[model samples]
Target chain A: MAEFVQLLVSGLATGAIYALAAMGFTLLWQTSQTINFAQGEFVMLPAFIMLSAIKLFGLPLYAAFGVSLLVSALLLGFGFKRLLVDPMIRHGVLPLVIATIALGIFLKEGVKLVYGAEALPFPEALPQGIWRFASVSVTVNDIGVLLLVFAMVLALQGFLSRTTTGRAMQAVAQNPDTARILGIDVPRMITYTFLVNAALVSVAALLITPVYLAKFDNGESIGLIAFIAAIVGGFNQIRGALVGGLLIGVIDNLSGAYISAAYREAFPLLLLIAVILFRPQGLLGRAEERRV
Target chain B: MTRWLLPAAVLAVLIALPHGLKSYGIYLLSLWAVYAMAAMGLNLTLGYAGQVSLAQAAFLGIGAYVSALLTVNGVSFWLALPLAGLVCFAVGILLGFPALRVQHHYLAFVTLGFNALVFLVLRNEEWLTGGTYGVEGIPRPSLLGLPTQSPIGFYYLSLGFLVVLSFALYALLRSPWGRAFAALRENPTRAESLGVDIRAYTLLAFAIGSGVGGLAGAFYAPLVEFIDPTPFDLGTSLALLLMVVVGGSGYFAGPFLGAALVMLLPEWLRFSESLYLLLYALLVMVLMATCPSGLLGLWAQARERLSRRRPPPPVLETRT
Candidate 1:
């Protein structure tokens, strides 16, 4: 019972990170119908940026984070939009998908060439120590991650429901043409979606990298798992992404502990195939009527 | 006479080309042939049928391992090669089942997940796959009354397979089956209305394409004399996709040209060392950004423009 509680706490912590990463995917899919295949790479790049700022430039942790977040919002966010996504959007989905896959390779190779391929220990961001309740014990780091993720989720919910810009973004997602007719800047909103996605992924990177380590190829696995999470929860709904992330995290942790550790990664993939096969609409998503 | 002239000249070049190259160069050419064969399969599926498959590498890996395991245990390479194709053809049909349920991006995800799953099995099943130690010492097959132990001999063998595969594909594409595939790509509903069996053709597209990919892998196992899970990962799958897209999907000659660019361009850019892949990625990105249809598509575009500028041939008329 105690061990189970410990596993659950850690699972939720990891699940929060996945939720954050999955949010980027759902956001892009929601707003523009663009699936960023390089999303894993997007999450990966900012960790390197933050690490470089701190190690090479001698910036403080908070300042380095700020710089990394800002760079992400610009380069990965706006620059990615203007450079790759915008030009290819005119073509159909295949081209865009191929381009994003190419972008992922470019990012992975670029990082390897520039930053070296070795995994590096990340600087501590959350508090250290353990909390014990009877036979159950949890790391402060896990608690810190859980708290931060919950706060961010609430803040995002509030912004989406309350703010003018947020509502405009939602309108654009609902109907870009109608949004345009109502004088909302659909293009700018799309850009904002990318920016918001970048920011969310960067934050996820910051939280998860310490546990996973900052490696050049980290995106491949991380991106894939988050994709599975989003799909399992529900591809179309924001709430679904969150639920899916947490669920995948817990499932991954429990399976890794009780099942064969070597095959833990395979479990999520199997779940993904099952979900796709039986429930293409996803657990939280409603079925849409198809027109011939 | 003119049509024969082009093919004859091309054949002359293919025959003469290997004799001039050293062992390493010959090996690269053979590798190109193998990859080109795989890309042709991808072309048939993605280009003609318009189904997106991210699992071609999985099929290739399946073929490689099957042939390797069989041959190393004393089975003839000839028998093992076809067996590999058969296995992949069956598996490909199974994969196509999901295509019935999902379309486009959803299908892409399903295939991608399948790829990851296959990769995991290949890596973890240590007792079966040697657990990354990789199977080695695969023998080159001897044809009737001839030996292919030499690099030059093997190159010809690979080339011979490629030629046969090409002719087979060409004939297949010219048949009704080919037209059905094109119809499926253009519009499934319209094709169904026209009495084309969408379900069977969809399965056939995957089966044949994957069968070809498996054949290429059978060649790959002996060509490299070893097998590992590394080359059969997502990277190679993406690289194969790159070959089809960059060469111009749906074009008959696309895979060959695309395979050459993908295989040989890196050799030419070897001076950059570590930066070669980065540079290659940039080039592909720029190409995709400017022209997603690929190199042949560009040629088609230029030809269309030139023809548009040219005056029409004068028509002969009979007196009323």
Candidate 2:
């Protein structure tokens, strides 16, 4: 039971990061009808930027993180949507998909060229050490990540429900044509969606890099996990993405522990396949009406 | 006049080009042909049928491993090749069932998962696949008492298969089935309304495309004289997709040019060493942004401007 508790805590921490990434992914999908294949690389690149801000520019950790997030928000968020997605998206989803895949390769190769291919150690942000209770131990980092992500989710929920822009973004997601007819700026809302997504993923990158370490290729696995989590949780629901992420995190950890560790990566994918086969809309997703 | 002249000139070049080249050059050409075949298969599914699959590499890997395991154990390469294709066809059909339920992003996700699953199997099944050690020493097949052990000989063999497969695909594309695929891609609901069996065609699109990929994989195993999980990973799948997209997906000869560009451009750009991939990716991105229809699309546009005549139907449309 203690071991299970320990695994559960760690898994939730990992799941929190996945949840953050999934929310970003779902946000983009809902607003733009885009499936950003470069999402993993997007999340991965910000961590490297943060690292460089600290090491090369000699900035303090907090300042470096702020710079990194801002850069990512401006360049990856705005720059990506404007340059890559907007132009190709009008042609078809396939072109956009292919472009994003290329973007992923570009980001990965660019990072490799600039940052070097090695995994760099990330500075710990959370207070170090573990807390033991009733023969169960949990790291403060895990606790800190969970708390941060939970707060962020709540904040995002409040913003979406309460704010004019956030509600406009939600309106754009529901029906872009209808939203535009109602005087909402659909394109601007989409841009804001990308911006919010970039910020959320930036936070995920900061939180995750401490545990996973900053690696050039971390995006591939993390991206896949995020996609799975979003799909499992329900692509349309923000809360579903969170729940799905936590579920995947727990399942991945438990399976890695109780099942064969050799196939840890494959297990989540199998679950994804199962979810896709049986529940195409996802666990929390409603069945979409087929339109001609 | 231009049609006959173009193909004849191209054929003459293909035949004459290998003799002047060294062994490594011949190998690269053979690799191009092999990859072109796989890309062609991917084009049929993604470009023609409008189905997005990232599992072509998984099918290719399946074909390679199946053929390699059989041939290394004394089965004829001839028999092993078709058997490999058959296996992929069956698997593709099974995967197609899930595809029936999902569309666009969900379908791509499913296929991506399928690719990962296949990679895990290839990596972990060490007793069968030799794991990361890879299966090596795959002997080239004999063609009617002719030993294709030499690089030139294998190049000709690969070229021959490329020709045969191209002819077969051309015939298939001219048939009624091809029209169905085109219709399905253009608008599936409309096609279904017109009494086209979208479900069967969807499965066939996957099965035939994957079968061709498997056939290409059969060649790939002997061409490399080895098998491993590395080349069969998601990278190769993406690369194959790149070939189709870069060449002009719906165009019949798209994969041929795409495979060449994707395979050879890096070698030509080797002067940049590590920066070659970055350059290549940048080029692809620029092309996608400016003209998502690819090289053929640009060519078509150029032709349209010069002739000022009714142009062929474009690959790009507003159809979602």
Candidate 3:
């Protein structure tokens, strides 16, 4: 029972990271109608940037984190407007998707070239201590990550619900033509969406770096997990990403604990495939008419 | 007369050139032929059918393993090759069932997951696949009991296969089924409304594409004399797709030209080995941005403009 509790706690912590990433992915998809395959790369770039600032520039952890988030947001905003949104404005969804894929490949290979394809340990700033309740163990970092994730989600939800820009973004996502007709600049809203999504992903990177080592290929694995989470949670829903992420985390951890660790990654993917097969709209997703 | 003679002359030169080239050149040619075959298969699905399949590598791995196992067990290479294609065809059909029902992005995601799953299986199933170490010592094919061990001999064999395969593919493209595939790509709903069974055509595309991928892998096993997971990863699959796109997916000969340039250009520029991938990525991005229609499209446009500008040949009265 203690073991189960411990696994559950750890899984939720890990799931929170996935939730953050998936939230960013969902936000980007919602506003832009373009799924940025480079979304994971956005997470990775911030982590690397933070690491470099701390190690090379001798900056403090807080400063590094701020710098990384700012840079990531700017780069993502610029990249979306220039590389993806502009050329694709006239082309359609397919070209935009393909362009993002190309951008992802470029980002991944570009990172590999700079980082030399080696996993580097991130500097641990958080205290390393654990709380034991009977057989269940909880670490300080895990608790901190969980709290941070919750705070970020709440803030994002508030922003989306309360802010005019946020509502504009949502309106753009729902109907770009309508949004445009209503005097909203759809393109600029998309750029803001990209910036916001990247900022969120950057936060995820900074928080998760302490838990896992930073690496060039780190994004690939986490990106895949986030993708699975998005699908499982229903593609467009923010709340679904959170719920689905936590559920996936628990399921993945439980499976890993009870079964072989090698099969852990397979469980979520299998679940996703099953969900798509049975409930194509996802657990919480509303059914929409298929567009020809 | 000039155009016809030029192509025939070029073909004659190509057929004889391999005999005079060095062993390394012959090897490159053979590799080109094999890749071209694989790229052609990619073209059928992605270009013609408008399906995004990133599992080309998985099918290739299947073909390689099947061929290697069969050949090691003393099965004839000729028999093993067709068996590999047939097996991949079956797997492709199986994958197509779920694939046909999903959206394009969903299909892409599924194929990506499928590729990862295949890689995992290849890495874990040690008893059969030899796991991470992979299977080696695959035998080369024997034509009429004559062993094809030398590079020169292998080159000729591969060339013959390429010629035959290309001609067969060209012929297939001209058939009614090919027209149906094109119609499906142009408008799936419209095609369905016109009595074309969408699922069947999609399955057919998947089967044919996978079969060709498998065929490429089968021949590849003999040439390389080894099978491993590295070459059949998602990277290779994406590279194949990039080749198809960069070469102009709509053109018949685009994949062939694209495959050769992509495969050979890196080797020729081996000095910057580490930066080669970055360069390739940049090139792909630039090409995709500047010329979305691809190199062939650019050439076609240029040719159109040239033909339009040039004066038509003087009218000649022929009394034949």
Model 2 C-alpha lDDT per residue in residues A214-267, reported as the tens digit of each score = 988999988889989998888888998999899999999999999989898888
Estimate, for each residue in B1-320, the C-alpha lDDT of model 1 and write its tens digit. 79668666866787789989999999998999999999999888778777677888888899999898889989999999999999999988887777545655565677788888888888889889886877888888999969899998999999999989999998998898887766666677788999998767766887899999999999999999998899998778888988998898888888999999999888988999999888888888899898878888787777867889755321111000
- Give candidate 2's error at residue B256 in angstroms: 0.5
Q: Write the per-residue lDDT of candidate 3 for residues B1-320, one digit (tens) a residue.
A: 77467546755776898887888888888888888888888778777777777788888888889999999889998999999999999998887777667655566666777787788788878899998898999989889877799987887788788778877887887899888877777777798999999778877877898899999988889888888788888778877877776677756777878888888778866788877766766666667667665577677767777889765321111000
TM-score of 3: 0.92
Best by lDDT: 2
For residue B268, model 3's alpha carbon misses the true position, in angstroms, by 3.6
Please report, as a residue range, the 10-residue window in candidate 1 chain B with the lowest summed lDDT: B311-320
TM-score of each: 0.94, 0.97, 0.92
> Between prediction 1 and prediction 3, which has the larger DockQ?
1
Stronger candidate by lDDT (2 vs 3): 2
Stretches of candidate 1 exceeding 4 Å from the true structure = A289-292, B1-8, B309-320
| Deviation (Å) of B204 in candidate 2 | 0.7
Q: Order the candidates by TM-score, highest first — what do you get?
A: 2, 1, 3
| Predicted complex 1: CAPRI docking category | acceptable
In model 1, the fraction of reference contacts reproduced equals 0.62
Candidate 3 C-alpha lDDT tens digits along A19-58: 8888888877777666666667777888889988988999
Give the Cα RMSD of candidate 1. Answer: 5.0
B265-298 in candidate 2: lDDT tens per residue?
Answer: 8998899999988888888888888778878878
